[model samples]
Target chain A: MREKLIEFRNVSFRYGEEEPWVLKDVSFDIYKNEWVAIIGHNGSGKSTIAKLMNGLLFPQEGEIYINGQVVNQDTIWDIRKEVGMVFQNPDNQFVGTTVQDDVAFGMENRGIPRDEMIRRIDESLTAVGMQDYRLTEPHRLSGGQKQRVAIASVLAISPQVLILDEATAMLDPKGRLEIMSTVSNVQDRNELSLITITHDLREVVQAERVIVMNEGVIWDEAKPREIFAKKDRLREIGLDVPFIATLADELNKSGLRISNEPLNHEELLEDLWTLHSKM
Target chain B: MDITFKNVDYIYQENSPFAHKAIENLSFHIPSGSFVAVIGHTGSGKSTLIQHLNGLIRPSNGEVHIGDFRLTNDDKPKNMKELRSRVGVVFQYPEHQLFEETVAKDIAFGPENFGVYKRDIEKRIKEIIPAVGLSEELLERSPFELSGGQMRRVAIAGVLAIKPEILVLDEPTAGLDPRGQKEIMEMFYDLHQKENLTTVLVTHSMEDAVKYADHVIILNKGTKYMEGKPEEVLTQQEALNKVQLDVPEMIEFLYAFEKRFGLPIPFKRQSVKQLADEIQHAMKEAGSHE
Candidate 1:
């Protein structure tokens, strides 16, 4: 059986008594080294799940477990060390003047030894392809580069699970691609559970599994292919399938044989060629 | 307003030790009432280029003509405020600029500052409310109380209230969801048509440029890399990739299809369904020929 890194059991939460519940009875499990993407429209309680996993906010009704330990006041600090989070705005997350200083900031707060901090800083920056930019100031770097630095800082903590909370929303298309590839590389090198909270369907297509959130609830949880198959339903819920999925559906409607869930351009084209040969 | 840039150059901190050129020797003409998309990377001087639209920054070593107003390094239009009243810029994260107590007040602030009549400001608010997908009830609510999408709509409504003839959008759909992005872009397109506004959109999404813009300008290292119709300019895949840009997914797919099936389906900005129809016809014709 796959080891579960994080689990939410019948979680429900609200900010205040008068306020409506932001998340309602949501439950899901993230296994070791799994890349799970949580997608929803704005204010859909998707981001709340990220906050709950690391004990930033406790669920009023249910429990969140991290490596078999329940998250509460006493265990919150320890749970936080196990889960690292990268927020949306790169400008707001910077606490250091230079790239290397920022990566060392997290480790310094944890009171790591100076020699060990230096070693981890170099290792993490190299992991994110930012080793050459160690002395570069945050302002000198591009949005994509700054985000890579942010990822390196998170990696320095050596957390078991990493949560990116709408991390690419403020970046351009190029920056978004850079962060995605960097995260993929880091995951390959480490046994890290990735929870990406985003609205971009392009990024969602790369995930191993997807959890769809709608109106403070778990609308659906499935693989990327299964989730994208219901294109019309996704649209109704204010989410979108990727362009390949939409185009594949169009080709199928025009009496052409194509997979309903082509993940990329090459796959859909290959299916079309197979259909053409028989004709 | 029609815009023309003649050998434009903008140097930040000029003559100082830290001097850097943001835009250099750029020349382009945007005809009156045309839609233009400026495509480039983050530091490719897109923001610097759009700032010249409203006289926010004067060209360091060139000429800029927006309608009757002219700007140069030494000379700017005496009536700078009037030029600003004619150009409305909806910046990235425009909601952060919202400061008024209520949505109605925020929408009225721009027009009121421009000396528009109080009665006319109220009329424009009423007309712009629905144009931005905001309802009448939202006019009384505080802008901070609204959701992210609603706050953005409120911010856009404020820009539209100015009744500017030239509209500049700098990644206006940056943080919106997929559906919200489509709705906002469509609304802007409708307003552009109904008002005959000259629209300049600085965007990273090539899909938006292909769908909405008639003309496209690409910048690389503060220079004009390419400029022409969207179909002609965006199809140069190698040139765009050199600048860290990509063709829209539809065009990319058609290129791959041609390579794989030996079928050439030219992209004329066709919808997905239309492209599928053309592909089906091409396959049938090829089979018959065989």
Candidate 2:
């Protein structure tokens, strides 16, 4: 049986008493060593969930549990050690001048030994493929590279959960792909649980499960293929299905008997080829 | 106003240790009232090229013509205010520039400075509020109190309030969600048509470039790599691959499907239904031959 790494029970939150609820009775569980993608339109209470996870914001109602331990003011600092978040703006999170110094910043705050900090700085940078630019300043690096450095800093803390809150939103297509692949490799190599809050469907294709949010609620939860199956509804809720999924849906609608929903281009082509050979 | 670049070269911080050539021998023309997209990887001189549109940066060498105004190395446009009023630029993350207490005042700030009468400024705000997809109720709220997406629209509305002939947008939808991205791009498209505004979009999204732009310019290493209609320029895979640029998703899918099935499928920016019908027709023809 898989262990639950994080759990949200009947969680509801609002900015203030007068403000409307940002999250309404939301509940979800992230399994250990699993990759979960949380997607929704902006102002759908996605980023708020990220903050609540790390105790940056406390739940106005309900309970959030990390490894079966309830999170509150007393346990916030302890919970933070287990959850390391890389936010949207890389420049905003970076506190150090050079890449190495930034990666070491988190560890230095916790008063890790000098030799240990140096070791983790090297290891985490290599994991994100940013080892060569350890001495380079943050401004000199590209947006994608700076984000990878941010990821490295998060990794240096050795957190159990890594929350990337739209971390790839500001990057170009190539840069977005770079961060995705790097995170995938790091997740596999390190066995870290990843919660990627994003609107990008391509990133969702790689995740084990997807949680759809809308109107400050958990709209639906399913595997990537299942999520893509609801193409019209997804678009209605302001999210886009992957290009291949849309293509498959189109082909199916055109009287083609596609045996199953194809998640990628190769799968779609395979389905077509099977039909073509039979024809 | 139509814009032209004549062998323009831009060097940042000339004669300093950090000096670098941001653009080199770049030359392109943007016709009046036409929608053009500038695409390239980061630091490929895309930003440097767009900065010349509205006098943000003068060329280090060569000349740029924005309608009647001419900009060169030694001489700058004398009427900088008039030049700015003619060309409105929405820089990346435009919300970062919003500082007014209320949305209406923020939108009015630009036109008010350009000598728009107080009464006209109010009229312009009322007109542009809905154009950027914001309700009239938002005009009274503080810009800081609005959500990030709403703040972005307010900022864009501020620029549109200027009523410029040409609008230059630098990744205006950079950090917005999918729906926000679509709404903003669609709003710009409508403005480009209904208002007959000359729109120049600097973006990283190939999908947006393929969908909206009449002309696409690809920049590489401080130079013009390719310039043509979106259909012609984006279909050539090898050329885009050489510069590490990505083709739009639809084109990439068509390419991969053709390679796998050995079927030649023409690429065009078509609706999903149209593409599905074409593929079905092709498949039926192949089946009958078999």
Candidate 3:
């Protein structure tokens, strides 16, 4: 779809009228059904950017357009309805004791019919791979499970754009994979656009596009391959290059006659096989 | 059970409607002089488990023992004032636990509380300042004014000041940049090795645990689910997946190699590149065999 789900036009935001702008003049766009990752070190204004999308923190200057509607006082609630947020810190975000109860809290606020709410809750939990623990108390579940429940809560609202702000930071490695897979599937199955703000570079491997932010500005933007090309620069921004990226860089340095095109293991293997067969 | 939990149970807000069981029938141990990493997805009762180690809470049904100190599941029976000196527990966001003005004073808090000599407290402050990778100049500065990573080191140094035999750090590296994460863990590793300290590291990063942990402990639903060396625990992908744990990404690649390429790569290779090199060599040897 050519439709732009969200657009920021020189968006600058501040916490208070007199306070310094938390986000300097910034401009970016999220197309419908696209999975875009916003990455930067802490205090690079990543969280502030995520807050802007949901209208949790409004812009002090410039403008943000969500679903073709300007994000402002008159339309903030509607914009939020279209762009739900899942924040970091599992312990702080939990509103209910039991997993089932926590997932239901969102629907309850919306005044969904009791029966429909029950069905939606089940569907959301299953979407995040957390259906088995619906009856368990959320506080008793592992960090990863709690995060899944948090995602389910956001999904239960059935918004068009899902913003996950470092959602996997508290989760262990396996849990991180589960959440990543769930997000990938959510975008595919539900056709919801995603704006994931995370410092975990491992996550960017699967993103459709990557946006690196620095001092509240888009420092770089490209597809995974192109973005990962500047490995040294990425590290300079306090970001990690992929293991594959490092390997490729090393091969280039070591005078290995490997093709420059292979970006992943599968591609590298095919390249090596072709080289060997030709020899 | 080096630190065993036998039919151990903990119910928060007990005797009221809000009552909840944090952990159930949990049993595990921390053998002396071992670096044990406890990997749980967030609420696997990790904090609840560590609290018992220092007699912070009296278990409702089970008993907790740290060396000679024995604790029944019921009743608060602990000479915890003394236990605090033996076992140092660094909670998450330990910086928030800081109160004193200067870094050195904050570190000296623990040793001072234990009624150690003033000279000994001063001695610990000076020695551990560098161990945590902080300069002596930082000793006089206000901890609140320091950067987050530096503040973290100060907090860790504070914990290190008392020089507890058994040190437990819960997600000591959460919210840090990659370099900060690596640095703090390296400090922990250094301290763990240089001193014969019994260390328990609670973390979500499999890479950190697999790299530094001598032993790995997995807690599931407030119970001691599994305990073994890091290598032994990680090889069981099925069990790890059940509790939502993962081997490092590099290790996962090796596991995939064995399943897909029919490669007979052994596990002794240390780093990712080492494993990749081994794979390269094995593939070459296989080609020669063909």
For model 1, the superposed segments whose C-alpha errors exceed 4 Å read: none
Q: How well is candidate 1 docked (DockQ)?
A: 0.86
Residues B1-290, candidate 2, lDDT per residue (tens digit)? Answer: 88999999999999999999999998888899899999999999999988998898899999999999999989998998899998999999999999999999999999989999999899888899888999999888999999999999999999999999999999999888888899999999999999999999999989999999999999999999999999999988899989888788888878887787677788778987788888888888989887
Location of the lowest summed lDDT over 10 successive residues in candidate 3 chain A? A248-257
| Selected candidate, larger lDDT, 1 vs 3 | 1
Task: After superposing candidate 2 on the true structure, give the runs of residues whose Cα lies further than 4 Å from its correct spot.
Answer: none
Task: Give stretches of model 3 more than 4 Å off.
Answer: A13-22, A96-149, A173-178, A247-279, B1-32, B40-45, B58-79, B99-108, B116-123, B126-151, B219-226, B238-244, B288-290
Pairs with steric clashes in candidate 2: none
In CAPRI terms, model 3 is classed as: acceptable
By DockQ, the candidates rank as 1, 2, 3
Tens-digit per-residue lDDT, B1-290, candidate 3: 25656678999999999988888987776678888998886567888888888888878887877777787855554576787788888888888887888888888888888899999889888788888888999888989878678888888887888888899999999888776777788888888889988998988877777888888888887877888888888667878777667666566656665665577666652765565456556766666777
Instruction: Summarize candidate 3's per-residue lDDT along A83-111 as a digit string, tens digits.
Output: 88887788888998789899999889878
Instruction: Tell me model 2's lDDT, rounded to 2 decimals.
Output: 0.92
Q: Which candidate leads the pack in TM-score?
A: 1
